[model samples]
Target: MRGIDVEVAPGEVFGFLGPNGAGKSSTMRMIACVSPRSEGTLQVLGMDPGVDGPRIRARIGVVPQQDNLDAELTVRQNLEIYGRYFGLSRAHVRAKAVELLEFAQLTERADDAVEPLSGGMKRRLTIARALVNDPELLLLDEPTTGLDPQARHLLWERLYRLKREGVTQIITTHYMDEAEQLCDRLVVMDGGVIVAEGSPAGLIERYSTREVLELRFTPESAPTAADLAHLAERVEQLPDRLLLYAADGEHVHREVARAGHRPLTALVRRSSLEDVFLRLTGRSLAE
Candidate 1:
């Protein structure tokens, strides 16, 4: 919403990493050509979204945060009908639906009404429907929200396959692990602004230490950031735990013990995208 500038490569996965209400969805809508921006110029897939909205939309696919499939229609019928909107031949749509059913792993349930399918099945069908026209760019808004672990991983694998097959993808998500796992390059957006941008590992290396020591204490015995400042490069105090950022977590843990600060539980782990976000935004991504 505020002077946002980003360019996604032809075959790479680009991501918008942010918490709720950080303008991720609004930005996605503009890129999808569904919502026009009030200011500044915009280009998607080499065309201005305002002047060439229809042409841009014809070559792009969008999977919204919610599944909007017709419950009365069968899984295959859903894809066929969506393909028809793009003016594809009926023969092409039929064959494409068959291929997409296999890709979504719903071939056996192709004839079943969408209302009876599992949540994962519905999510996959939504994504398959988005691909019915063989879009050059795919925009997914929180593609795996509210799904079980198995379903989430299955979707991740499908996305990986798409990347391998040269489909350019833009994903918006609050899940730091998902962003780290799926994105080749990403921008960390906060309050309608890009706070940082880089590959996940690059951002981690730039913004966070190599390791983090997490110490959880009883409410009465918790140490303040100032109390642990000498033990690590940086100390962050949270309601549940204290994060000690350091190049070596074990060394910081040993120092904390030497300093006579005992915690209920201590964990030494590698830094993550979450840590990078916390460092950049001064709050957790879930916030």
Candidate 2:
């Protein structure tokens, strides 16, 4: 990782946005205290990770990119066993498991084996297990990667509750909409370095126009960036479409018509985090 520096305030939902090999996972590992940094200072929850790794880890909850729940164990047993590893008494672990099961909306499946549960159920259980110690800080790595929309919203609601209760969270995600919805403040990283940092709206306003006019045409008739440059503030040519960035998308669309440009389909939408991401990270796919 490069010389990355960031500060996440208490009770805030901070996000890390990047493509593959952007050092997000490496940074997360260091913050979780499972991997040591080679240089520079690192602090998590007011303690230096190098000196207080265990203490820091004890106070933070981590929901990894993938669920690692023991498939052989029942849903309730997964939570109870994890809490036991924290040295909690059996009675306390039992009570905590019950509360967490309800929080995860998995109480009905508490007695069922992990292997039989749906992907969403397993994800919820993993999150509940992470919270067994009632951590002050939570680190989530792609908390809702593969779940259906319904399950994604459910997880978002649960996270919102945690935020309301003043539990600080740091999340790393590839989904632009998810980051925009959950993050109060975020930083965009590329090639192991932070390139941009701000709230979702702030970044969009800074990096993009107020609206976007998307125009699609047949492959052979597609307009180049130079062809539509005067119709909008800027134009981005994609393999399938042309994006006209402007403060007024409808105005640009009308201008395009007046300029004798006909597209197969035209869509005018508000600028979003995805627009800002592609602008900052480039439209090319990251390996």
Candidate 3:
């Protein structure tokens, strides 16, 4: 992927979406002031990152891709140690830890050691720890990568609440549904650059038809691209299926059936960001 260029408005949840090794983490690090950009202009909160790294960092909350919480300390102690690094007063740190524990739904486990926490619990604690200073902007990199479905939903609810409270968030994830549910706008980065950028709906509208018709057949009997020609505005052949992009999926399905070539299976559905990414990059969003 190429280096991306986009702006994230305050009080909005902006998602950075791409596959592994797509430079998503690289971009996040630069914005977090942990890694400096080699070229191009970069700014955060209207301040030049190169000139005011410390000041920019002070106002941002970062939940890195990896869990870096101190395993030797209890959940509450971890928050206290992080708060101390920000030069917060002892009284303030203690109060903030309690509030964060509650916010993370970890008040019951406040005194529990980090080593004993489940993956989901650890992730939530890490998020709470990041908020100890009440940052103006929050950055999350693949926040739910290793989480189960229930845990993912819980985290999403917490993030939604934060958004309602007017927190500006920058999230990076390979999960299509997560981006659709959480991002107000996003940029699709591939290689080292941005291939597409818009709201999830806008990207789908611009890159793909309103609906898609998927036709599956046995590998040996699959219809060739030429066979499905004229059935849709565009036809894409996949390993085991043919995608027909059209204005009306049901109508396209009828057309396909009328042609006397019966697919083993077929379905019509509304277009999604996954379709948009596949159309633009010629690969799945998670690939």
Candidate 4:
């Protein structure tokens, strides 16, 4: 991955999106002050990370891609122990632990051992633990990677609540929907550089047509990309299907039918961040 430029305003949710090893994690680590940058200027909260690492880190909350909860401790104890590292008074830590547990919807599990919690629960606890110090900025890396749909949505809701309460956030995720849901602005990273930067809608508007028509055919019945060249602004050929990018999906659908190409299946949908990434990178965002 390459070093990239980004500026996130206060109280905003900024998303960093890319495939595995696209440098998203590298960027996040730099921002989190866990890994030193090899070159270029890096600033968090108007302070230089190199000189003020501890001070900058004290004001930031981090939820890593993987949960690192202490399995030997109960939920509340984990938070209590983490707070001690930050030098919070014992009384303050106790109060904060209870408050955070309630905020994370884990009050009932406060006494339960972390080893017995589900993945989502443990993730929530990790997030809660990060908040013990009342950070001004939160960093979440691939926050929803392995969760079920319901769990993902629940986490999204929790994050949205934080955003509403004026907590600035920087997130790195591979899920297009996660970017669309949580990001006020985002930069699409590929090969260690930013390929595109804008709000979800802005990127979609700039990189893709207004709509997309997905056509699938039998393995033996596929049409050449050239066969649909004039049907839309752009035509992307894939092994199993063809994506026609056009202003009007239905219009392109009809054009494909009139061309004597019978597709096995067809669907029309609005453009999305996934379309923008694919258009710019020439590769699926996740793959």
Candidate 5:
């Protein structure tokens, strides 16, 4: 994490994006005061983590990359126990547990043992637990890494609501769609360094065209970027297909046919965070 500089504003949903082992976790841990940085200035909530670790931690909630729930405890008890660890009154903790159960939509399963719950349910419970203290900042690491589509959307909605409540959040995700859906501002990290930073729309506008035209051709008949250079602003060639970046996708698609090149499959869609990442790192976000 050398030469990395980051500044997160209050009441903003800021994100760190990178592929596996790109040092996103290392940087996040430093900010969380769980790991010490060899050298850098890190201030969380206007306090230096190096000197005020305990105070900083008390005001923040963390939802880690994986769930670390007490499997033997009931859903409600899990929240209650964690709140007590923060020295909350037993009565307050118990009432907070009920509120969190409803917030997580787990009121019916309040008494269920943690081990039997599904992955998405466990993730939500973990988040609700983090909010037990009513911290000012929330740190979520890959919060939707392994959920089904419906579960992912539900989690996203909860996060959106949290945003409305003005809980400052810092999230780290490898998923471009997740970053786009949740981040107000984000930075792309590669090999422990920031390569790009901006709001999603701002980054896309700076790094990519408004739309992308995808053309998949047979292995033997794949056309070169040089052959279609005049049709779009830029061309990115992948193993299986070619990407044509242009403001007017329909016009570019039509130009492809007019140029006497026919692909096996063609798709035209708006540019995404994936495109911005690919442009910056010369690699797919999936890679």
Candidate 6:
């Protein structure tokens, strides 16, 4: 993660947005104190990670990209065991486990074995386990990568509650919608470097137009960018479509039809963080 600099404010949800191997995970590991930084200075919670790894870890929580619950244990036991690692009393951990089960909405599955639970339940358990110490800062790495839509929404609600209680979050994700919905401020990274940094609305306004008009044409009959050049401020021709970057999508679409460049389908929508990413990296976010 060379040439990368970041600062996260208290009680704010900060994000690292990029594709796979874009150094998002590497930066996250450094912040978590699980990996060492080879160069440059990094401080977390007003302490150097290398000098105070254990001290910093005790005051923070981490939710990894993958679920790593103990398969043989019951849902509630997982929380208890992790809490004891910090030298908390068994009685304290037991009560803490009860409270966390309720927090994660897993009170009914308290005794159920971990392996048979659904993906979302396990993820919630992992998060609940991380909060046993009630850390001040929370680190999440791709918190909702593989879950279904319903599961993703549920998790988002849980995270929102945490934010209301003033837990600072540092999240790494490749999902554009997730960053837009969750991050108060974020940085766009590609090739081990940060390309852009701002709020979602600010980034869109700075790097992209207010609206985009997407026209899909078949490969055999695809029109060149110049054919629609005069319709908008800029034109981008893709493998299956042409993007007209304009402030007013409705008017641009009307002008496109007037120019006799009919496409198979046309879609007019607001510009998104994906558009900003495409403008910076010359590739889709999914790439």
Per TM-score, the best of the predicted structures is: 2
- Would you give me the overall lDDT of model 2? 0.93
Per-residue lDDT of 41-107 in model 6, one digit per residue for the tens? Answer: 9889999999999999999999988888888899989999999988889999999999999999999
Candidate 3 weakest lDDT stretch, 10 residues: 278-287
Residues 109-204 of candidate 4: C-alpha lDDT, one tens digit per residue = 999999989888898898899899998999999998898888888899999999998999999998999999999999998889999999999999
What TM-scores do the predictions have? 0.96, 0.98, 0.95, 0.96, 0.97, 0.96
Regions of candidate 3 where Cα sits further than 4 Å from its true position? 1-3, 219-221, 284-287
lDDT of model 1 at position 9: 88
**Residue-by-residue lDDT tens digits, candidate 3, 89-184:** 999999999989988999999999999899999999999988988888999999999999998999999999999988999999989899999999
- TM-score result, candidate 3: 0.95
What lDDT does each candidate get? 0.93, 0.93, 0.90, 0.91, 0.92, 0.91
Please identify model 2 stretches exceeding 4 Å from their true place.
none
Number of backbone clashes in candidate 3: 8
Residue pairs with backbone overlap in model 3: 1-190, 1-191, 1-192, 1-193, 2-192, 2-193, 3-192, 3-193
**TM match of model 6 to true structure:** 0.96
Deviation from truth (RMSD, Å), model 5: 1.4
Residue pairs with backbone atoms closer than 3 Å in model 2 (clashes): none
Candidate No. with top lDDT? 2
Tens digit of per-residue lDDT, candidate 2, span 114-171? 9989999999999999999999999999899999999999999999999999999999
Residues 132-188 of candidate 5: C-alpha lDDT, one tens digit per residue: 999889999999999999989999999999999999999999899999999999999
Worst 10 residues of 1 by lDDT: 278-287
